[model samples]
Target chain A: MIITPIDSTAPPEPTPTPTRTPTPPASSASVRRSRLGRTLEPFGFIAPTALLMLVLMIVPIVLVIGYSFTDNVILNKNPEFVGIENFVTVLTDGVFATAIGNTLVFTVVSVIAHLLIGLAFAMLLNSPLVSNASRAVFRVIYILPWLFTAAVIAVLWRMLLSPNGVVNYLLSSDLEWLSSPALALGAVTFINIWAGYPFFMVSLLAGLQGIPADLYEAATVDGANGVQRFFNVTLPQLRPIIISMTLLDLIWTSQQFALIWLTTGGGPINVTEMLSTFTYKLAFSRYEFALASTSAVLILLFSMVLAFFYVRHQRARD
Target chain B: MSKEAHGRRRTLRVLGASAAAVALFATAGCSASSDSGSGDGGDVTLEFAQWWEPELPDGAFRELMDEFEAENPGIKVELLSGPYASTKEQLFAGAAAGTMSDVVGLDGAWVSDFANQGAIADLTALMAESDYDDSELASQIQVDGATYMIPVVNFVYPMFTNDDLLAQAGVAAPPADRSEFAAAANAVAGLGDNTSGWILPLSLEAPNGIQNDVMSWVWATGGSMLDGGQPDVTNDEVTSAVEYIKGLWDEGAIAPGAFTMKEQDKVEEFTNGRVGMMIDSLAHINLIRETNPDLKFSISALPAEDGFDGERGIPYASWGIGVAESSEHPAEAWKLVDFLMSEETNAKLSSIANAFPGNTESVPDFVAEDELFATAFEIYQNGYPANEFTGLPVAEQLMRLFDEQFQVLLDGGQSVDEMLQKTQEAWLAEF
Candidate 1:
């Protein structure tokens, strides 16, 4: 015999109400006031955050933009407005052009390397053959590089890559890794890649775990190989996370200054000079705050463009 | 409650919280201002910012400050100590904000820039107003004929040689001229096992490498990179010096990675017994000894050019003192400066720091106690202290510019003439 299931979690149907005395209608002024309050309530909740953003973010950005159009700025008492002359000078600089090229290479190579390395590690950890205990140990080992601060990483790599260091000892080669004009940029980029991949690995691992097992089972039932499963199922499932991580990594790697400053210092004749270092030298080393501000604004614009794409991608995925 | 009443209450709560936050921030700012102002009970507080305290023996500088406090009851001193780079950054920020410390430790390279920007006080005028005696001071860093900094202690860069390496190379003594120096360097380099003859730190990050290592060679022979106080980088003396160094580079006599090596790395290499010789500050002698006590080394004058007979020019750096133009306690700051420059105090400071006293009349006891100090003292007495980068506008930038070109020259990217000409033009633009 079929038994009808009871819906206990659902609310009971409303009972018939008895007749009651009618209340007087409210006045027009009170109705108008209530409507106005309902409209303004959300704004009240957001007022503090909006005020903080105005003071901390918008104010400094506006000040920096104003300074970019002036001459000599902080070093001079009464600086004169020079319109876009500072921008003109920074754009015309050969060192700045070199910095742009170097930054592009460093960022693109670092992002690509981070993605490949992270994905490979995440796949290994996610394999069904791997035991939980072994996965835990391997996960910790893979994430070790990201735990170190930039300064520590810089010093560690410097010691390892020195001409007489352990790396040279193992290779039996005396290469000037950080100092060679041709090798300096690549060396720094490699270091950044080492330090950065763990971030991607952790994020992608979560994304990989979130994929339903039924999809993989279905692919296997359809006669797909391991590589085919990855390409057709795993990659497509993780595309959103991968895109987000790539854009974020690109932004971070492009702004890297401390590691390069502590390592090569954009040296061997500016072969590793990034835009961050170039701007830093203009302001602090050379005391040309106006030009530094101009360079900074240009960087901001570039970053804003990247951010626009990032936001658009995130919206579309949502 | 009615909806309008609830909304009004919520709005009032937010306004009240924001007011509290503003009040908190205002109070914090007021407290910070008060903390940075003069002390209680009419006592004047002078902030003394410097990089020397860390470099000196631990707590030795604090003791000196205590002595000053004991002598001057009405004025109190606060020490704001840090590394040189951070100190420079902080002081520059302070200068721009017009909140500089009353007393400041300066480098000779910073004097011209600080003076030109009106950040530092004219010590010549301050001295005259205070009736302070200036005769005993060894030298003063001046800008446009106005003294801005007084050297409190001097550390000269002298050639430090590993006696063991030299003996192994069959050199009887430290080279006395450029040719002998070159021969000794090559002989040592031939010893192999990753050994090199010399370590030249030409890193543009701290381009003082050019001042202390490269240009010191030119100065060793009474040569000058300046003509009538203007840059003469293309002059014959500089040309000869650059060519000599380039010859060494071609011979592979200099250490590898010299292009990116820093001054500290040079010191480390020498201390680790990895190099035969280096032109380094006498201030590092104690550090080298501390790091490697078994290492045998000797100090001597940097070798002069061949066939030259004149007093050598020793490249010297100093722990300089100055007062901020924005200081409220300028008089008290002058007292601190004068106290530091006094013969007794300068002697005590120099002895503790393993440096020569800036007061020529004051003799540090290290001269008689430590043989290395004695040798350096002899070199100091026989040679004239000279550094062309001192008192030059944007001196550090000039060094970086020259260093970039020098690296190119060493890499065979350009001729020595082209490097010097390019450097001269860059320097002229800065000047």
Candidate 2:
């Protein structure tokens, strides 16, 4: 749990005063009552949200984790406790291995693309050369892809990358972008970067805006060039936002299902098979609910490890 | 009465009237139930969920439903139709929630899984009572010793050729053997740059496209998708068949987007005069005829490999209606099935569907008169069901594994031998 700025705004830390002595409760019962009241006070405010999280998030996760240990296929009337059979099967399966590799590659490539492209756009938008009206127009244009549903965007891209589609028509090249096994994953990764960069751009732009103008002015006075200022001032200032956005982008990209499913259905082969799509196919298409649940738990573990590593890396950099 | 008292009295009168009206409506519902029981008045609506196109300019199915309602007097049909993919999805959801329709239109490939899951009722008793056991379609819908579906329409997947394209390419006849098919395809490819000699559905967009569409060739070469209820893709016959397809691909006879085109896309391409020939179900014949009336086309069985048995692969797959296991009104549901599978109704509907009727006695005059349909009917009666070997509960997964490996081969990333070995290993692990 990386502490955000909101967490820093909590109640002031207690200070010890040598000159003034504070009186304590006279009775143990009164002290106990005070402690109990204090302990439960925040819970009163959090109870509704806690209950909601328990029901909507925690409950389903628990059920999935439980089901992963059983032979809980949808067609099976009674799911018997099979211990770790499903997990063992999932671990031994080659498709699961392929899915893991695909997911990692997809996440890393997509996050990097989003960061690089987003940073570039943010810089361009923040530049003195761009007019305010132009900045506003470009912002709208850049974020437009995010506004459309994933299904619609996927379909639009599918048509565009189709064998005889607009891409081929315009380029006069007979490239099978979405259908070729070698090219399909790259095509989807490109689409994802296009659709996702806007989020990064928006967040990075905000972070960029929040940096004090004096810092850049000071860097300039110290004989720092534009590149030097960006590296020393801009990047450091935007570290927290970059870290959080990258973490979110990694999770979202790994869990992406609809766009890949709708466009290539995880393949000309399983070339574009992500863990999310594969898990969905296991449960819905194959009715292997237990295996799917196991895969899902594995994904949760992957996300946790990724977040942990990112937080640690950020701490090390600091 | 005083003015305030009079207003209160008026309100009470209105409430009294409303309560009486509600009571009368409740009574009427009871009476309707009673009337259905007595078979004297009122309608017994049976919900029928299917994936067929809802309306086709005075389609035979719609007409038959109207006729059945009029003839039966007390029975009415409520249709729940949607696209096939979503309908199958909803069926699974409905099964889990115990809210499945009284009768469901099921693909033949799904029968085994659904029956094993106990999602559908065993229709053995009903069929015996109705003497439907005599129908050939009955056996196709049976698993082990139990029948679970009333087959309505059976499709035979055969090769269809655009006669004009074949003629333009100076090909005189439909190919009857693999070598000839390849030659003809090359010839057609030579006709124009825009034209493809053959269109192969290599896209695993849907498992059915790969499992049934492309695998039909493997079957034609006397290869089976499964061996003894286990996933087996590395057998010599199947491997050789795939190699032959790869040979076709190598020769540039296959379409440009062979790996992306769905079955429907292939049909669309063929109808648009882009492909000389395509392998698809007989059900698409009517669609092609209606969509491209000027495109002279002919249908034939898939070409068999040399030195193999003369019998080519003609898929005898079907779509049928089944009573839900949880249906309360099994008798009423059976009535609808019986009506739909009756000789006359089945003939009319199956004709429109461009399929062989489940009712063997109901081969329409048109089917018998047309040479192509007659050939398809003969094949439908004699040929093995496309899903006979691999229609197990794990069919989809098995097909997916094959699709993955086959795709590598298609992309020229792996040899046929290596692809087969990898696919076999995956299959063994899964099984």
Candidate 3:
């Protein structure tokens, strides 16, 4: 009994157990997962915008593609699946070829003029000769055409270019601008360039402001004159913005519906029929939705190719 | 400031922002919800889609709606009006979505197309209950032995003459024949560079505009736009008419901008005394009189070719009302259509719209107030209904086919024979 009491009062001897290191906070893999989650946190904030793009943009494109393969007349309740019949019809159609040609001509000519005028104004505004106040005023004035709606601009130009209208009056020439088969497309293209260049002006002006002044100074010190400096320093620096804007302008001008529709409506013998107006006429006028959808898909493909160049440039920059 | 006070301020800001968002959402939700409900308190609501031009005097339609609502206490109506194009677009969009208005106003030419597509309901039974079921105008809306719509109002395309211009040019008013027309046109055209002798709506804005303006010429030559439901654009009559128009173009008798001027632009030109003679619908008489009180003008049947008698063919276009196939309130919709076709309502509407009533017996009294309406009414008797593509499911396409070829010919890009042949071939390929 005395021995049991001694044992009960005494502390137990420590066992020879290997000591475990304090858990190394968390595993490296877990740390990487956490880091990934943190990186994805920003994506979470943009998910709603991404979802909208998917629904609004991507879904419509998919639907259009699906419709392109069907005999989807507006009057028909049920669209029959016709495989590549619609595409075949569209491709074989002569009107589509003419429309493509018009669209190309319109885009090329308008974009070139847009860039030249936009860059000219942008350089002028970016010059040291321009006071801040004067620059602000000129900016607003130059942007005025852009602020106007396409319909209003088209109507205004239609009035101006009319045979008995102010433009002929000013020029003292009885030139029939919009009604002439030779001049209708050119006149509309001119109006488009007028209305659309201001966008490029504003965008290029901002881009010009971002270039380092020292680079231009150095360019001047290297014996480069105004034109030389522009071609070597300014243009090279503005290359990204120019490329991006060119792509955007190409897409917009190719899909220019309102201006052409309001002005010529693919008229004067369809010499001004762009793909956009042609598709619209097909759908709304002819109720040939399947053919219109095929045309629309072709336009989308063309635009996407241009968009691809833009996206590739952007990703490369990143 | 204390941290606690800052926290309190932040909390208040968040709460205010939340309240603002909720209120915004509530307002948006209310507006979205109200789009579906009756404006006035009623058990059932029906949407009546109409192309009531707001810019024009439309008080008669409003009065008709008021009368209808008074008589039908349980049902309320909401008007959906806009330009013809916009209204048609809305109706079509609604039809596709199964949310179309119970009653829709459609161009008469499109009735058969809509009926064939089953976009509109067959009103045969409802029309049978009405006295106008067997009327000539009602017959225009029938397809495949079923009356799909009730014609409401119509317009006849006629020539308007500026009396002062005629006197100034020493040309007689109401050119008796095509020779006189050409002479008057030449005289007026020779007056000044700004003044045109004649104005034709060569613009391809719509088939109705260009076709009505020029097809009457063809018809006057005993030509037809359609030969047994097929386009005969190359027929001798059409070729002769085309040659005449081209001659007018070459002679500089037509307005400088006539090739591209819309119907409205033509009206503007005529009202402003810039044109001596203009081909337009009779509906513009009131508008012209209002715009130019001192501008004396006369309306007459379009002139015939020189050798032909002064007798002419007038093109008439119309609009009608129909029930949507998907209408939930078709019975109530029929009531609106019935009321619209009633003699009293028809008279009132035709007067305000400056149109001839679909119910021939209900011609408005004011129609006799002016020689223009009188002439138009007389011509309406001989009008060919101008439903050139009736029963053609590809009606709009046929119109477009004609429009394109007509545009080419107007632009002086091709010969009449070539253009017509091309159009004929195209029509054949499509049909």
Best-performing candidate as measured by TM-score: 1
Clashes of each: 0, 0, 0
Point out where model 3 deviates above 4 Å.
A1-47, B1-42, B53-60, B129-139, B205-207, B220-223, B307-312, B381-392, B410-413
Q: Tell me the TM-score of model 3.
A: 0.86
- lDDT (CA) for every model shown? 0.91, 0.79, 0.78
lDDT of 2 by residue, B174-205 (tens): 98788889999999999865798998776665
Q: What are the models' TM-scores?
A: 0.93, 0.79, 0.86
- For candidate 1, write residues B1-431 as lDDT tens digits: 57777777777766756765675575456447545647889999999999999988889999999999999999899999999989999999989988889999999988888998899999999999999889999999999899999989999999999999989999989998999999999999999998899999987677788999999999999989989888899999999999999999999999998877889989998898889999999989888998999999999999999888899999999989999999988888999999999989999999998888999999998999989999999999999888888889878888989999999888889999999999999989888
Docking class of 1: acceptable
Model 2 per-residue lDDT tens digits across residues A1-318: 234366666887678676755556567687686677557555554554555576668988999999898886566778899998888999998878888888888889999999999999999898889999999999999989889899999878977887767999899888889887788889999999888999999999988989999999999999999999999999999998898888878878888988888778888777788898889988876788888999999999988887897788778878
- Give a tens-digit lDDT track for model 3, residues B347-380: 8888887888887678787767876678778776
On the 0 to 100 scale, the lDDT of residue B255 in model 1 is 94
Question: What clash pairs does model 2 have?
Answer: none
Q: Candidates 2 and 3: which is better by TM-score?
A: 3
True A-B contacts kept by model 1: 0.39
Q: What's model 1's lDDT at B61?
A: 98
The sequence of per-residue lDDT tens digits that candidate 3 reaches over residues A148-202 is 9988997898789887789999999988788777888888899999999999999
